[model samples]
Target: MAIRDWPEGERPREKLLTLGAAALSDAELLAIFLRVGVKGRSAVDLARDLLSSFGGLRQLLEADRQRFCAEHGLGEAKFVQLQATLELSRRHLGSLLERDAALTSPTLVRRFLSAQLRHLDHEAFAALFLDTQHRVIRFEILSEGTLDSASVYPREVARRALARNAGAVIFAHNHPSGVAEPSDADRRITERLREALALFDIRVLDHFVIGDGEVISFAERGWL
Candidate 1:
């Protein structure tokens, strides 16, 4: 049956309005984005088929233009819309972080960093430069590398910190492998960054390794 034919409370849009977005399943949320379905399939049914084909929501969202457009019920228009939506979400999270001290809102920091780096197919090293008050100065991606490694230069990091007149920094990198565990190299680089920044009176607050569904913090592990 069409979504309109279903009970109003049971429809994805109605359920979202009533119980909130968190109450909806992945397919339901996707159905709302899809808006309509082709031929005999309902929007929810189409969403289910697309999710199954892509292996899950993340894969579907992260698919390249060619791959995403090749799928049934999707096209360049949908791809553009999806990308815009994802970017808006990231900017919203970033705006929230800008309103508070980074150290005081570790959860927001994690969410913002994850939103920035998680969707990348390759490894990326990023930093959140902060003022003496520990409020964010800026967020920048310093380097991007292969699927597993990104070359991070302490000197370049220190230079950026100096340029920003940052009092402190929180470093983060993403592992495309989906394992949040800090590798030996991760530890060494973070330590080097700490030592280099210390020379200029800039503190290294934490180093975070972002992976699929997890973010590991050096400070939390007592390593910072």
Candidate 2:
């Protein structure tokens, strides 16, 4: 049914005023942002079409600004509203990240690293910096090569961590061979880095060996 013809209590705009934005369905939320539809379609109809085009709100939010604006019914103005809404969502995610910086266990570290590792042809070692309360401040790529101590200098990593004033770190590197298990070289490098960073009071949370849709943690194996 068209929004204006729907029962007043069930309409998205009205319900938002009475029950808040969180109470609305996905289509209702998008419809409110969309405001109008093209030709014979209502705002809700256009919202449904956009959902089908992008595979739902999460996927739509992850899309590039240009791609969002390129949709047939989505002109620049409507796309800008969608982009602003998604930007607000990102800020919310950032706030959540800041409130809980601690990686806690290996599983959480793996979950966090999988996205960055999913598409890599070579090893990419990264350091995730955490604050005093264990909230993540930022992350940096330390090195990229075949997982070996000679390639990834512990001293260099230590220097960078000290410069950033990183309280804790969770190190991760992708395995091109799609094996999450650590190699002998990988273990040695992690051990050396752990020892070197300890002197600077930089706690090593975990070392992740990322595979395709999988990860192995050194700390979880009692190796770190």
Candidate 3:
């Protein structure tokens, strides 16, 4: 049946206007952009298929152009549209990172770190160096570890933090295993980071162990 043939109130486009986009299903939301579907399918069906194949919104957003284009009935024209839409959304979110805002709050710290380290497969230690006003001045990836701090360089981190004049630092690292718990080495490194940045008066506000869409805060646990 034509999409319009559905109960007028139940249709996505109509519902989006009347109730806002959040009221629609994921398939319905995608269909508005897709406009139509290929033979034997409607836009809703195609969107559901896409989400099913890709796992969900996160995986779909990260999917490569070739994979998206290769999907049944999806061609370069539609694939490019998809690509542009995804990139635009990503940039829009990234724009939220402010260079001079106070980040003394845990809510801001999670918002910044979660977006920065969402989909990595390996452990990456990064520093969000903030200015006096708490605005983000520099975001530096300090170390990449295979198993532990075997690869993280403390002296180098100190050097960069000093050079950047980072008034405060928020440390973030990822757990590829999807566990948000801090390991012994993680705590050790937090201690090391706490000591190293002290001479510069660079406060280590929090250390986050990010994994599987959740974040564990060392500060929140009274560890930092």
Global lDDT scores for all candidate models: 0.94, 0.77, 0.78
Arrange candidates, best TM-score first. Answer: 1, 3, 2
Q: Which has the better lDDT: candidate 1, or candidate 3?
A: 1
Candidate with best TM-score: 1
Q: In candidate 1, what are the lDDT values of residues 132-206, reduced to their tens digit? A: 999999999998894222478788889999999999999999999999999888888888889999999999999
- In terms of lDDT, the poorest run of 10 residues in model 3 is 99-108
- Give the per-residue lDDT of model 3 (tens digit) for 28-95: 99888778877888888888888899898677765667777778867789778876775565455445
lDDT at 58 for candidate 3? 70
Clashing pairs in 2: 101-134, 101-135, 101-136, 102-134
TM per candidate comes to: 0.96, 0.63, 0.84
Collision count of model 3: 5
Please tell me which model should have the higher TM-score, number 1 or number 2. 1
